[model samples]
Target: MIAWIRFAVSAVLIVTGLVSFAAGVIGNCRFGYVMNRVHAGGIGDTQGLFFIVLGLAFGEGSFMDILKLALLIVFMWNTSPVSSHFLSQVEYYTNPNLYEHMERK
Candidate 1:
């Protein structure tokens, strides 16, 4: 059923978010580095947002509520990337050691 599908999707999103958070924490603690932190953060946002929207879909919500939830999901998806890009730019600029790994002439 559709409800089952929504529940499954929500579960998957929540698991993905948890895994990403764990990876971020482990990477920071083990290496004292923030490699892929932005990616992990974005994954957290995306998975968390989708999980919420899917939960709403499974709830006793009206058509308008579902529409609003969809809009929120779309907005989150759009803004998450922009925010990640800005964060990455800041990190890249502030951390010269990161760029030292880059191949250069």
Candidate 2:
């Protein structure tokens, strides 16, 4: 029974991760601006990765596997936002009419 429960939970988490990735793809394709696409990509990088890794960890029996997955999640959590910020700044600096899309204070 416990094993079955674990399987079900892991399956749900993996499916959720897949759904997050799908949403990110849709958002990236639907949005027009590079910054918007970067935001969507960040969703997949962080939440999608976290869910997938967490599901894999749930299915694994070894402590080391779980530790590695946890580390992976931590690494992404730390890096994804900084990467997104850098990309956004790059877009902001390079785009000729960036203010056209964004409202000026």
Candidate 3:
């Protein structure tokens, strides 16, 4: 039925969204720390972790709930990097070699 199809589509979106969101969070956590090992500042420290937690928490329960969760996760996943970039720019400007070892150029 149409309802079942809708439900299936929503579920797929939610799962894929969560998976992508999780991967970004974990990646940023791991490498972000390594990039700033001595310091205690990175995307993982700010909205990144918060978004992931919120997404997971919000994703629970019914299909509608998961849809909202998926949307939040997608939004966070898209914006986290941009936020991180700004944060990094702030940190890098203050210390030009903040990530010297990892810097490509």
Candidate 4:
């Protein structure tokens, strides 16, 4: 029973992570603005990665595996936001037409 519950939880987490990633991809495709796309991607990247890592760790994971996943999550959490910020900064500084292409049409 406990094993089945664990499996269900892990499955749900993994599926949710995949859906989040797909949503991000859709957001990127639908938006014309670079910053918007970056924002969506960053959010999805972090959330999906965290969810997937947690799912993996929850499924028959030893302490060391969970520890490693924790570290991985921390590393990715730190880097993803900073990279997104940098990308947004570059777009802000380099793109003179940054605000021009934001129409929803």
Candidate 5:
């Protein structure tokens, strides 16, 4: 019973992670511009990765593996936003008519 419960929980988490990934893919495909695409990609990088790592951790029995996964998730959570910001800055500077897509505040 315990093993079955673990299996069920892990399966649910993995499925949730997959769904998050799917959402990100759809968002990336649907968005029109670089900044919008970066936002969509960031969703997958952080939330999708978090769920996937959390699911993997649930399946693993070893403490060290779980700790490593936890660290990976933390690292991703920290970096995804910074990378997105950098990409946005790059887009802002490089795009010749940035004002057409976004209004300057």
Candidate 6:
């Protein structure tokens, strides 16, 4: 019974992660703005990968596997934001027209 429950939960989590990834892909193609595309892809890369790794950890049900997965998640959790922020900074510094969209007081 416990095994079956674990399997079910793991399956659901993996599916949800896949859906998030799909949404990110779709969003990247759908959005016109550079920042928007980066945000969309970053959401999928971080959240989707986290969920997938989490599901895999649950399925493995071993301390070592879980530890490794946790490390991977932690690494990604830290890096993804920094990367997205860097990209945004690059766009802001390079794209002179960015301010055109803003209203002056």
Point to the candidate with the largest lDDT. 6
Q: Point out the worst 10-residue segment of candidate 2 by lDDT.
A: 96-105
Q: List the residue pairs that clash in candidate 5.
A: none
RMSD for each model, in Å, please? 4.4, 2.4, 7.2, 1.7, 2.8, 2.7
Model 6 C-alpha lDDT per residue in residues 1-105, reported as the tens digit of each score: 999999998999999999999999999999878888888999888989988998898899999999999999989889988999999999999998997644454
Model 6: how far is 21 from its true place, Å?
0.5
List where candidate 6 sits over 4 angstroms from the true fold: 100-105
TM-score of each: 0.61, 0.89, 0.48, 0.88, 0.85, 0.90
User: How many pairs collide in each candidate, listed in order?
Assistant: 0, 0, 0, 0, 0, 0
Across residues 1-105, which tens digit of lDDT does each residue of candidate 2 receive? 999989899999999999999999999999988888999999999999989898888888589999888888889899999999999998888989988888743
Write the residue-wise lDDT of candidate 5 on 1-72 in tens digits.
988887788888888888888888998999888888998888888888887887787788689999999889
Q: Ranking under TM-score, best-scoring first? A: 6, 2, 4, 5, 1, 3
Candidate 3 lDDT tens digits, 19-41? 65565566656664344531333
Which prediction has more favorable lDDT, 2 or 6? 6
Where does model 4 exceed 4 Å of error? Answer: 102-105
Using TM-score as the measure, name the better of candidate 2 and candidate 5. 2
Query: Against the unseen true structure, what C-alpha lDDT does each candidate score?
Result: 0.69, 0.90, 0.55, 0.88, 0.86, 0.90
lDDT of 1 by residue, 1-105 (tens): 987776677666666656765665555455533546666667657775676566656663578888988998899999988998988788888886886655454
Q: What 10-residue stretch in candidate 5 is worst by lDDT?
A: 96-105
Superposition-based RMSD of candidate 4 using all C-alpha atoms, in angstroms: 1.7
